[model samples]
Each structure stands twice: as structure tokens, then as C-alpha cells.
Target: MGEPNTILHAVRVSLRMSQDELAQAIREDGREHGEPNYCAKRNVQRWESGDVRMPRKIYIRSLERVTGLPIEALGFATPVFGTRAAAQAPANGQESARGEVVEMGATSAPGGAVPMTKHNDHGTLSGIWLSRYEYHSSGRGADFTGEHFVVVIQHRNKLTVRSLPEASSNPDSPLTMDLTVDGNVVTGSWREETAGDGYYAGAVYHGALQLLLEPTGRKMTGKWVGFGKDFDVNTGPWELTFKDASTSKAAMDRYNHRP
Candidate 1:
């Protein structure tokens, strides 16, 4: 029973491996050195519990040979290896200091031996959610006076549909069109219909809402044509800001600038 043996057992338990597994691994490692009988489950347990002392060289080498981990990493018994003091020392000095320190349960960093960071989702137009917007002209003598809304497109039936929300003046038959992003083309028409003489009337509408990505999410941008029985409308360019539950500004900047 010795300090080295006790530490070795602690390392084995931390790794969640049983004594038999470690013993077999050790036996396999010993074969490389023509000392094939060096490991057994019983022997490993006695060595780990400090019931017996391990040959220093065999003990150190067996760590890597048995567990496929580096010798320095098996210094799991110490908790000060990850401290700022350890980082300032030379490599060999750091290893020595780490090895000498007794197990204090704080040697390992908060992120284990390796660093792990979580990914943020934002700025990408993940096809998991939907978004929409509307545009209203704000000038006199403007060709378009009524409010024109742009619905962020949702994929459906091999087509992308972008529509304007129905206005109180006229609910059904709102401005809308189908767009194909891959080809950069839009196909559809604006048709005006009359409901009752007072609340609704036949107005002209044209202009396909183009897709655009904004700081928010996928947005639609386009112009309004006219408000008559017969009007000619055309497609306009708009950016659809990609939006998702996890989209972020930093992510968007990186995505747009990536090579």
C-alpha cells in the first residue's frame, strides 16, 4: 500500500473502467515488453489500493500502454495541475509539479482536460421557423398609397410562397407571389376583386416581394404599383435576412463574410 498505488486506483475509478478491463489492458501492454504476465485483475486491484507497491517504470509506462492516455494525463490524483501557477512553469516542470501534488479534487479544470464550448444559433435562415413584414408608402404623389405587406416565404409543394396579410379594406386576394431563390425568379400575378360596394373595391396591385435577410430574420421587400381596375406590376429585389431561433448578429457577420 503506497501513495503511487492509491493514486493509480483513483485514476482508474475516475475513468469508469473496472479492474478486470485495466488488468487485461496491462497484460496486453506487457506483451510488447516480453513481460506478458505482468498484469492481472487481482494484481491491479492490490496495486491500485496501495496494498502493494508498483515498479515505478512499469507503473508509469503501463498508464499509457493500458489506457491509451498520455503519462502526464494520468496525474489525475492532483488538483493543482490546471492552476495559473502550473501554466507559468516550463513543460517538464509543470508535469513534475502536477505529478507530485496529492489528489485535491481540484487539479482538473472546469472543462476537463479538453475545452468544450457551446455553439450559438442565429443569423442563419434555418427552415425551422417563419417570419413576415409589411411596408407602407410615406409620401404624396406616390404611385402606391395603400399599405403593402411582405410575407417572409415558407417552403411548400416545391414552391416558395410570399404573401401580404389581408388588409381591413380588403381581406382576401391580398398581394402575393411565388419565388424561386435558386434561379432568382418570381412567378405569380396580382388580381383585384370586389366584395361589397362600400368596404371593398377593385384596386390594381403588382410587384413581387423579393427575399432579404435583415438583422431580425427572413424579411420581404418590394414596391407597390397602383390602385386601379387594371395595373401592371413587376418583380423587385429585396433581401431576406436569415432568421432562426438561434441566429445572432456575430454569426450573421461571419456567415456573410466567409470565403
Candidate 2:
């Protein structure tokens, strides 16, 4: 609605980060660099809700102190007070939610699908970073556990797959992934090169998963499918969850570093 506030909102959303995670990241930065922490979780919430305006100096210092990112990386906030057309504009045919028409990169896919470039604002797709669950079919047919991570990549609605791995239930044998999210869909692959012992042969494993995400009334939901080759095991599923990249990233990070 006013100077600075709108900018903060854009930065948060663009980062695909929760207010709490962002706050934690900022706190970690302060502790790492020996700077006084600027805001707590509640403060971030208030800012997101437009409850208060943090000082400009604090904002700049926080960015530098936390992410070590350049100030210019955060763009100018478009004033919230604008006509529907003006508000929806996003500079390249990108339609703002408020009805302003901006120039957005052309998407071959209909209905506002643009290719996802990176996992974060940093513009580098490291991999799937987190995992929420692992599903297994019960001995009884047609029974399954909760949803799990499915990574998919696409170019103009055409499906392309990377790889898929099961979420590790045992601390001993863990699963992780690196993912690519292009717009509403995500694509990436991972493998557990070496198993603990030769008993299973761990064998060469590879697979791919894909997800299609849509915003529900208040939340986002996605449909997913997966196909995989695990040593002598091969399985495919037509259903899965559409998890955010952050979740995948965290999972992969843990899997890769697990002993």
C-alpha cells in the first residue's frame, strides 16, 4: 500500500519461502556474522500481514547480513495502489494477480505456464532439497501410505523426467534428490549409488518422477506420477504429492550427508 511494504511482499513470495523459514534464515545469518538479529518470527509475520514497516536500513542490513545477496537482487516494489490493469502488469506479458498486464516471458503452455529456471532466487537448480513422506502399498491390494515427493520437468507441456527415489525410513539407508521446477511442475532425479552391503547388491538404481501443481481455494495441490528402476525392482505409480522445492532440498541434503 505504501513505499517498501509492497517490495517486501514480492521478495518473500519470489523466494518461495515461508515467513518463519525466512526469519530463521535471517536469524542464522545474524548469529553467523555476529550481528544483532533484526526481527523474530512474529516480526516477519507482522511485516507480511502489513502490520508494520521495518526501517529501510534494517532491511538492507538484514539482506546483507543473512543471505549475503546484493541489494539490487530485490526489485522495487510496485505500489499496491493501482488500477486493476496497472496492478496486474509484470513487465513482459506476465499478468499480475490484480489484473495489471505486464510483459511476461512467452509460455508455450497455455494458461500461464512458464518454464522454471532455478530452485531459488539465486538462479541455480541444486536439486530436490526435501522430502515429506514415503508411500508403500500395503500387502492388501489398492492400499497405500501417505504421499511422497515426485519431481518432474516439462518444456511447453511436454513431459520430461529426471529420476525418483523412495523416502528413506531407516536412518541407515536414506534417499535424497536434486530437482528442477519449471513453473508449476518440477523435474529432477537422484540415486543411492552404494548400499550398505552387497546382500541386496544395492545395484544400479534410477527412476523419474513428475508433478503438476494447481492452486486450490486457499492451498496448492498437485497430481504426480513416478517410474523407477531399483536393482531388480521396477515400479510405477500414477499418484503422488506436489511438494515444494524446499521440502525436496532439505530431504536431499539430509540423504547426501547421512552416514
Best candidate, TM-score-wise? 2
**Model 1 Cα shift for residue 28 (angstroms):** 79
Alpha-carbon lDDT, every model? 0.38, 0.39
Where in model 2 is the C-alpha error above 4 Å? 1-167, 197-201, 214-233, 237-259
lDDT score, candidate 2, position 24: 79
Error of 1 at 60 (Å): 79
- TM-scores, all candidates, are 0.26, 0.28
Please give the clash total of every predicted structure, in order: 23, 40
The top-ranked prediction according to lDDT is 2
What is the lDDT for 161 in model 2?
A: 22
- The residue-by-residue lDDT of candidate 2 on 48-136, one tens digit each, is 44333222344446765553234433323223324778544343322233423333223422222343334422232222322333334
